[model samples]
Target: MDLSTPPPDLYGRPRADTFFRFLTAFGDRYSPALGGPLLRRNPRRPFSRPTEALQLVVTARRRVAADVVELTLADPSGGPLPGWQPGAHLRLTLPSGRERHYSLCGDPADPADQADPAGSAERSGYRIAVRRLPDGGGGSAEIHDTLHPGTRLTARRPRNGFAFCAEPAVLFLAGGIGITPLLPMVREARRNGLDWHLVHTGRSADTLPFAAELRALDPARVHLRTDDEHGGPPTGTELLAHAPRGAAVYCCGPAPMLTAVQRALDASPAASLHFERFGAAPVTDGEPFTVRLGADGPELPVPADRSALDVLREARPDLPYSCKQGFCGTCEVRLLAGAPDHRDRRLTPERRADGALLPCVSRAAAGETLVLDL
Candidate 1:
């Protein structure tokens, strides 16, 4: 029984089925290098997927400015949160235990997207600004008014809904409450030594936070326009009228402001205009529809009268849901079959084409029985 190497038959056996699995993984990463083999092997994989959440307890909370509050979070095991890129957002599940996305405005020195949950203590801290809106009291007010230090809340790993580009020059447009996300981006841009400018539109300097920080950003570069005093909307005639041509324009604010910017940038490079909505997503011409949770199941009726999530809640009050606005992707479910009339703005085009749907507000076409993979 001298079987020093008796397993000669198993040598090539391991390579038979998985002869190219390693190559496949390699080709997947280096797509441009092996684009042919990669696409031919797996053609339908989605470009992006919803993010995952990690439960982080609040270790400390401090007010930095009149509106902005500094919050420190750590892993459930009392370790630091992950390092993230500038303009990245952490999904904060409020005390009411609902989730909302907030931009991190703290140190942008480290950019760790896939940070380890265990050893993230050194890069554990993050900063977010909360402006209490009179009409908005869902979560921001809770963090501002009710929540305190040592409170435990769940946090989704940081995600980049807006990221800076390597363009030679860039223009950042911010309306009243829209500066939160752009704040970090500007800091990071300056750190990277990029040529950038800001157009901040507000009722006045009193209503706008981070005024001094933005003002100190090179007088020749930063422009603060107050409608209450400036007498007009910051527009092509006001803001973009003197915009340096060929710079990427990133705008975020009220729909009206964003639409105006979009219309102006429309004639320019479509690739250069980037926008993100601070409020609910806009999906017009929506019609009533029905969704079947499974095959032969009772088709739940969805009304344009209300959101799909509202209807689902009216039907089953026990179902789990966090954000009804489609930001958290907490209520994510797979589509077993049938095409979905996706209305979410968070997901990319490639993802929607993969039959993904957010049950929150999205609907289905007539005669289309939407199936949920939950």
Candidate 2:
């Protein structure tokens, strides 16, 4: 079979052959029969400087809600895990050998929250939660179904894209599983005595993860809205009504909720809005284009349906990439020429003007050829 052109699925998306190869590689590297030595082989790419993958054991697992499962990962060596701040997430290499990013929801400062206090060793652990997405990608389902207590997995240290800022006042709006990253932020706010409030919504009370924990922090400041109870979701205007002018607002949720929040804050003066998305920014069909690697490398064609990262990976498999949805800056490349259709949220307007582009989810303009400093 020609690996380049696989049959398109119902959505007309081409299936890359590299996925199968990755699965084979995953098994060879992580197979239990091979033992700890083989698993110790670092999976970090040369380009992913200062970041490396570590082996973690599942010390505990429990269902937090109807479809959500919370996992506690600890270092097998019984040592403290890497330190992280609020709004940080870990990239775990799953059973299928695919990488998935999950937010760290547990308290970073508390050693007991992360480690086994029973042992004499100063052990620490990291806590993360996953919501099963049956109809969506396979990562969440694999975590819920395959991962368990005593299971071993590989994960990268915490990388934070959504860093919490100290302001006069803070308002957080979360929808469904999006609450994972914001939970720690709310805790830090309270610990520091900063005024903060959280407006969380889900399909129903049963589906809201960490409902009790959030309410315990502060009932008056936390607002819970359920579609089943409220007859519909709360509007962004309603959630932001209590926010004072110039307050810092952070939101994470489904696209609709984020869009609504953006619209609500469009007219507010002096308010700073921050967002963290689990998926790529909504993009229309892109036009076919070509990219030149380095100054003299071959000009590779990027299909409209494929990402630049996929095309570049054909020649450079070592290219660092995680969360290919463009939320992560691992696949960022310097643009020497041509206009980029700036689709990634990670790059600021100034960085885009400075010729920075994330190849994972971004594309080129019509009939434009991009020269990359690969």
Candidate 3:
């Protein structure tokens, strides 16, 4: 069967009935009276343990751009840090107890390879850049104002939801600080000698982080377009014009730019596009609903102003959750029944069809009651 094509009985009433019949026949043929081992399945689903939080100290902090700051975090005990691939992000627990996620922008190669043999060569560190969001949430402000060298912080092991695709060629489009996750991907592409091009845009040259570093990487392949110098931002038509046929387009940027890129890629049949959003998923106009955790559990009221995860956590505080913005899949639960509004960006159309829901941001239809596996 073609991997891209869905099976005829992939999802529907027919599939469920067929599965039920198969299970019944199998049980009848392999009974305990036949002297064979009884077929018993585990009741609980296997789940991978969560990544442990690392105690890291800020070793260096520098302003890389007008509002962007680069922070270097190292293990306080001087040990090797966890390895991470391109497009990975670290969830940081701030001093105020607020959890925030930031992408790793530095090189993924072992730092020990280039360090002196006697000077903690085996120890590795992570470099992350953050842009101050004055009018937005307080996480960025906390990092900018209070975090400094010698300050200790806790962060989870790196996890990646956005990953690089293996393609013959790639086109990278970054807007402002969105370039953080794509930085390592560009380096890897260059190291592998892949055909790659980068288009970076910002309000002004001063606002674009890593401007000098990106220019030095490959001036021929890197295109910088600033609103001040170009009269306006580069249009999607101009960006795609440089993308060759069959190339994979990876974009991480402001919502407006991403929306425009999506529209442009929709018109292009030769190139495939992937996106990573730095902000929360677009909110929907939803009404209050009810969520039943288990068959015998009490129904919880989910208010329109609150999330299902928040409501459920009030009663059951052990529920797993991280990055409440819905980008991470930590809070995903099996949907036993109900029509989900499905607002999460992590779940694909096919996965949503498979009865999975991200409770952190997803909701049920108005007046609908959802039954969850929790």
Candidate 4:
């Protein structure tokens, strides 16, 4: 293995590879630099890296769909912004202290390269779209309701778990706002004159953002399917009809749609599927456990259907957590007792051995009781 070339991160972004991968995966407390610090089980602040986060201003905001809004973010100074490839997403820290990931929907090239005769302030910007969820954890709602032009926000570097694969034959499947990441992929495919087709499905035309813009690229290749027009949602088999025998399939959508597409892929074993989910992954084969906030604290029952983070937050509402999927390492707490299942993608074995566990996705063994330093 090439030590210089780190492996893909938890999100699978190839360009996001870094030496930290080695430190996190193999390093112990004795390891130097990133490892020693990372393995510290009881740091005052968990994975705090304020300097790496960019403070950006909202240069523009517009409602692109019924409940989706597109935002253009740029550095406060007129300077070149970081370049990202298709399928990248920004880990945005909202003013309300909530963090949410939004796909980079705009062109990958920095806007600074394009000359604007009118001296528009759109230089060096990254664009993202958010769909307001009435029942979500308040991140999306806060973004839709409060963010506007001139508003400032913090965003980590772009990470792409769903990197685009430039296959000879490509089929893109997008459901509703899931089109954000796939938009740039389609553009890249078109720009390269690759053989590709896109099937965008939604509840209706108004719910799909950039519908007209996508259609304008290639009306014949871009297929728009809506429940209102199509009578009902298409089956997995029906949707797979658009693909060639060995075409690569990229899909981002609601859980049901993703599941359907995945199930259909079993029939066409030659074709591969890549997907990205915006919500917490459902607990699978979970076993019940008991958790204590502190040594002498109250013990709470963790059911199979719910995450420990969800239950713990009800008691301690101020518990910090983001990306309940377990990649952010925000809900990491020192484990005082019990063996953790260790399901998160962020923490390394050494860290876990040092008594650290992410409450968001990590849990104890069946019928086991875990003591956390809440």
138-252 in candidate 3: lDDT tens per residue?
A: 7889899999999999988777777675466989999999999999889878877788889999999999999999999999999888999988877777777768678899899
For residues 170-240, what per-residue lDDT tens digits would candidate 4 score against the true structure?
88999999999999889878876778899999998899899998989999999999999989898888777
For model 1, give the RMSD to the true fold: 11.4
Q: Each candidate: what lDDT?
A: 0.66, 0.80, 0.79, 0.81
| Ranking, TM-score, top scorer first | 4, 3, 2, 1
Evaluate residue 306 in candidate 1 and report its C-alpha lDDT on the 0 to 100 scale: 59
RMSD of each: 11.4, 15.7, 9.2, 6.1
What stretches of model 4 exceed 4 Å from their correct place? Answer: 1-51, 110-123
Residue 111 CA displacement from its true place in model 4, Å: 6.0
- Give the poorly placed runs of model 1, Cα more than 4 Å off: 1-80, 110-122, 267-271, 291-307, 310-327, 333-339, 342-357, 367-374
Q: Higher-lDDT candidate among 1 and 4?
A: 4
Please, what are the lDDT tens digits per residue for candidate 2 over residues 181-219? Answer: 999889888887777889889999999999999999999
Q: How accurate is candidate 3 locally (lDDT)?
A: 0.79
User: Against the correct fold, how does model 4 do in TM-score?
Assistant: 0.84
Per-model TM-score, in order, reads 0.69, 0.69, 0.71, 0.84
lDDT of 4: 0.81
Between 1 and 3, whose TM-score is larger? 3
Ranking by lDDT: 4, 2, 3, 1
For candidate 1, what is the TM-score? 0.69
User: Which candidate number would show the highest lDDT if scored against the true structure?
Assistant: 4
